[model samples]
Target: MKQTGIPLAAPSNPNHSRSLSVGQSIRHSFARYRGVVVALSLGTLLSGCGVINNMMYKTTGDVMQGFSREHTIPYLMESGDLAMGCAMSEATAPLLMSFGRVTDEPDQLAVMLYLSAGGCAEDQGREHELAALAAMYERKGNAAEDAMIRQKRAYALASKRYLKSWQHHNTYYGESGTGECPDFDDDLDEFIYLAGLLSGLQALNAEIQSTSSIGVPKNVGSIVARASSCLENDKWWGAPMALKATVWAMIPGAQPEGEDAFDRLAMTDRLGEEAGVRLSHVFHAIAATNKGDEAMVKSVVRRHAESLKEQPANAEWAFVDAMATNIIVSISDRLWVENTGHRTPLGQLGSFWDDQQKEVETMDLDGLL
Candidate 1:
């Protein structure tokens, strides 16, 4: 009779009941803290995103820095396209410098970029100077004044940028004239060091030309002159000696006793010519111009032009040679514009307006007849 009725089920085991209760407790805890779990998941996702972003930025910066140092700079150095080099420096500097926000500041690259961009500005200033001369020759007083103003403005910009380049150079290689030279890793490093020295000198010169307070140190000329000793004059195509000589020529009392600035410049000229990198000629011309020695300036230009005919540019440093030629041409153009109201005539970089024409020996058709 008991079996016919519904039999009572055996009681569940206490351990089983306890396990069920624990499972419920876990679910309840999870439900209560669901918002916290979601927040944690979101935080993890965001943190991962930040890591990925940082990695991407780092990769981009590394690639840009490497490409610039390895390929871009070397290629530009080998090429003889001054305009293209200037354009590239002007265009890419901001973009490259922007990487500093996320990565190490590219101080080494900044030295080159600012140096080049300063050159671009200086070139524009030269052009304005030429325009001013042209306007003066034509008796256009207002135009001449405007052009001179523009020229000074450009020079001021150039001074600022050149100063920035020098600053970056110091940042990367320690300050020059610190009583110890940096241990250069390679030729490129040495070259950059030399460039930094040049940038410093140029900064001071440009500031003087600008007639504006660009805060270039007054002692930069002496500092660069001292630092130039770190480099081998002959190894760098006489550039070190040329730099030192220019400073001596420019700064009063800078010339040490028994050291003739002009004589040293003359020696450097020969050295530069033999190397097919006549940067010394530019320095010579600048010194002569500052001294108001028109004859010497013309002689330097003539020598440079003749040297170009006798020796082609060194293939390894064609761009540097080309740059020297460009500056020399600008100097010639200034002379031409002042006297003849125009730039140097095409194919006449070394020729001047006042030169005596050589007698041309013509074939005697009449004698043949």
Candidate 2:
């Protein structure tokens, strides 16, 4: 057997060699472009992730904000537990405020939360004040001074928080008294407006108590008094009038002509008592305390205690009534602590340590026995 070798034939078209070269060039170009395509795709994917994350955050913040305003606030308002409300506000404020980084800030909620948190700080300050009083009673001068320092520090913190509340309020509602009252969206909006006014006034009061330059505006008192007129005194359970009267009592010449501050306070007290809200009592007591009118303070407390017995708190606004009562109790405690070195005894809110005893018919009781 013999083996035969065959030679390959040449390409039919002359351009076949050119076509091969072109194909090779195309393949090389695609290979180089593949890296660039991969880079572009990765960049697009990362950009999409950023968009998705932002949308998620915004949605979450919106839902949380709505739920808090609609459900949480109303439920809290119905509750009578001031301590629990204060604690919740203090704990959740930071978490809620952080959402502002991703979305619009919840300024209305900030007003309420910061105000409540400021109250918590004020309560701490009161505790220190009580301790200072106790130390003074014991003649411990150094201990009293130290407690006073701590009290002022707590008050300073309270003032700062309250001022923040006032600032946020201005952000949300625009500068108050710049023009006509804001067109309130609903009852909640009106309520928040009132709260904002209270926040400004409280910021001023707290700064004064702190004895520190916390930068609270001195004109806040007058502003709050004027702003308070926006709310109807009767609709808000006499709170608006009480706020105005309190300003008049505190700020010299703030009262308008023919308006007696004490008379307005007395009228508001009756209105509050009738409404079962009784927030006016707090204002009256505060003004009395500021004036060093111990008798007036005691009268306010006694009247409040009597009103509680005469009329229960309105069911829809029990929390507000309860808070007013809590403040009254604190005032009573301060008086008791100052004189008796203790808080008011349980079941004796209206009575004092030196209250006059009523005469009893001892002979009739013995004969009956």
Which runs of model 2 end up more than 4 angstroms from their true locations? 1-35, 356-369
lDDT of 2 by residue, 86-121 (tens): 999999999999889998899989999999899899
Mark the regions of model 1 whose C-alpha exceeds 4 Å error after superposition.
1-36, 358-369
As for candidate 2, its clashing pairs are: none
Assess every candidate by TM-score.
Answer: 0.88, 0.89
By summed lDDT, which 10 consecutive residues of candidate 1 come out lowest?
1-10
Give per-model CA RMSD: 5.1, 4.0
